[model samples]
Target: MRSETREASKNVLGSPLRACCHNPQTGYFRDGYCRASEGDMGRHIVCAEMTDDFLAFTKSQGNDLSTPNPDYNFPGLRAGDRWCLCARRWQEAWKHNRAPKVVLEACHESTLEIIPLSVLKQFAIQAMN
Candidate 1:
């Protein structure tokens, strides 16, 4: 049932969006997906499970869980809404890289059909730095 729903969503969403981050100093490519909202930009279809690592990371960053949802400029994200595991991990990875800045230039959504683990690894490395 879940797989069916995912497939249905994939069909409707067209495909995941992709973005690349390049280090100006070394011209390294850091690729990843840009999370997007579904349905009139009012709802996010991504589901994440909170984990210990995520809790610790958010705690360390001083992100108060008690606060209202942040104004992400996206429709459905409300303060206090917890991120799914994937989103949490994505954020942590971005933070670890300290990539100076992550530049997300849009790419064909179909081009990002598969999650780029390599790009994620690179992001992690940057975050760790």
Candidate 2:
């Protein structure tokens, strides 16, 4: 059953992870390891359930912008935004905790364009779990 489950997951998630597994510019896996594209570089491993945890943790840290005097600075932030600036702050915290290869690679690519905070929040939420 475990093997079957693994196979099922592989079938579902294998493609995108494989496609984004390598840094196109560098021709190397985001983790700095060199392997054929067929190899599992473990790049796209993140869960969706951790969003609430990230939200709660950031709120507890006093960075929740919904509260007055938010712990983090959000220069251009405005009121009534659905996305919490605090959540972006939490992602920054998560980034510092450990340098995952895939995330490092994504960061590298992110500089070329703006990565939306909401997308990042989703990624962080998925990653934590």
- lDDT score for residue 127 of model 1: 18
lDDT of 1 by residue, 31-96 (tens): 222234332121222222224454445556765333344473222323222332233334444467
Q: Which window of ten consecutive residues has the lowest lDDT sum in model 1?
A: 21-30
| Cand. 1 TM to true fold | 0.28
Q: C-alpha displacement of 108 in model 2, angstroms?
A: 14
Error of 1 at 111 (Å): 12
Model 1 spans > 4 angstroms off: 1-8, 11-35, 38-46, 66-91, 94-129
Question: Which lDDT tens digits does candidate 2 get at residues 10-104?
Answer: 21222222122221211122332212232333222221122344445555766442343324332221221223122234345466552111221
Task: Give all candidates' CA lDDT scores.
Answer: 0.29, 0.29
> Model 2 residue 55 lDDT?
44
How many steric clashes does model 2 contain? 1
